[model samples]
Target chain A: MNNNETTAASKASKPTHEHTHDHEHSHLDETELRVRALKSLLSEKGYLDPEALNVLIDTYQHQVGPQNGARVVARAWTDSTFKQWLLEDASAAIASLGFTGRQGEHMVVVENTSDVHNMVVCTLCSCYPWPVLGLPPSWYKSAPYRARAVSDPVGVLAEFGITLPTGKSISVWDSTAEVRYLVLPEQPANTEHLSEQQLGELVTRNSMIGTGLPDPASAVSQ
Target chain B: MTNNSAKSNLTATADVLRELPDIPRRDNEPVFDEPWQAEVFALSLSLHEQGVFTWTEWAHTLSSTIKEAQRDGDPDLGNTYYLHWLSALEQLIIDKNLGDAAQLNKLHKAWDTAARNTAHGLPITLP
Candidate 1:
């Protein structure tokens, strides 16, 4: 494979990748710098407090995220009593685990069965339960996702490489500021003997979003 | 603004929070693939907290920016949401007299040039 004698596809793909990456990277860098510049301006002008900025960043970065949601899902899979309690009153059940705050004041838990699969979306905006699930991925907030999820959920799921069984029913729940929804993905097979922690290890953020599935292979590999 | 007027204004801002959803985000860590998106998010929130602008005004600015982008033939894919956010932030800063448009433009150019010259995986410092 000589660099000068590359195939046409390879040659084209390389530049496209580089161009796209460069464009996006530069845009991101520009925004980051602008924010930094703005911070300096505000700080110098005495309009902003540095300590508050750190606290906000620290809270989002560490104190909140998907692991909290994973714990709740894992517990539901292992404890029938708790699962029933969760289905009846999610806010209380989640608060029992001590993950409650802004964006999670009202929560609705939808369970996935063999015949029915649950998916979550916010057609108008991104409304996620930040206290438990953490911040959302960039794709979740994209225009294509917001518009497509409600209109063609299966197709959208397929685009994420998730192919459901032909006869299975798909339900798309739209989240709003008043109520946030979480998808309780069906537990994978052959994990009956596993502990709650072990079950949680199998859950991915995408699985909870219904854009992905829990694989037994991941558990084995780890 | 008078104390009563300010109180009403703040209540209107609070009502906007109740009615509309701002800060489009998901439930995993690092909501953005790029670091700059988070920076923009934090900057807006920080400014709002410092009383530079109400969240309601920021939300309106961002929503209008997205709407304008759509009118201009944006395909409405989710990827451009943050671009609207950045645009709104810029406009708000200028409108509020918190930042100089000329200075921002200068810094943007400097950052772009610096980023282009820097190697991949290295920290980009504005010259």
Candidate 2:
């Protein structure tokens, strides 16, 4: 491709890929530098303890995320007794799994059954269960999704490529700061032999948020 | 401010968070995409703890910063959430007389110098 010369004298400049890569590399470095300076200022001022900051960052960076919620879903799918507990006292049931946190203090697990589908939205702001879901995706926080999810959940689910059974009702739960709702996505069919761990692998972050569903067993086995 | 008081008041900031204008968050903590995002989060909380500005002022600063960004055509697609947060923190510091633009500018320059002198793989100590 280099053999074909450009008419605008652009060949004199280095290849575009290399030029752009350097630009991005420096851009990242600039952001890194800014962070380092900010850290130095806070450290020098003695306002923030370095250890505490690391703990806070690590909590979100490593620990809290959708996988924890996946485990809860898997447990409920296989154990009817635990499922009853989860639906009734989600915070305690979830805490039993060692996913306890203030962000998940008052959780309510809404089951997705054959008769109905569930979705959650915070109409006023982004109130999400972080301990279970990590951060809300951009669309979840966007005004359109927040507004439309409540007004037209069926349409919103369609937008997400979900086509519910013709008569399956859709229910939208408006989340609040005091109570976060987690959807226990319907267990996929034909997975009777799969273990709980295997079932968890079928779950995606969106499934817990009710924006998506668990991958079908056959699709996941691939 | 004493260390003991700061520790006691950390949870209190969570309540103050409720007063801020619409912002994306998970749990009570602000949602962050990068380490710097979390850094800004902790920095603001720390500043609040140290009495750099009251939580009411923090709320006002963040709300106004967000409004300004919206007015300036920030599409509010959620990617630039932290940039507005950083702006709010800086604005509060300057407005409250805790720091000024000149000091922040110098901090950035010093960091740039430190970063330039450091080897590619090494940690850049502040200049």
**How good is the docking of model 2, as DockQ?**
0.12
State in Å the error of residue B23, model 1. 21
Residue A122 displacement in candidate 1 (angstroms)? 2.0
Error of 2 at A122 (Å): 3.3
RMSD to native, candidate 1: 11.6
Question: Residue A193, candidate 1: how far off, in angstroms?
Answer: 0.6
Q: Write the per-residue lDDT of candidate 1 for residues A1-222, one digit (tens) a residue.
A: 234334433656565545434433323355566766665556556766767766767777777788898999999999999999888889999999998854324787889899888888766556677878887777786667766566566656766778887677777787765677888889998888788998888888878887778666766765
Task: Give residue B46's error in model 1 in angstroms.
Answer: 4.4
- A1-222 in candidate 2: lDDT tens per residue? 232333323544766655433322222266666666566655666665777777766777667778899999999999999999999999999999988754323788989999877888766555678778876776776656675566556556666778877777777777765678899998998876788988888888878878789989444564
Worst 10 residues of 2 chain A by lDDT: A19-28
Q: CA RMSD for every model? A: 11.6, 11.2
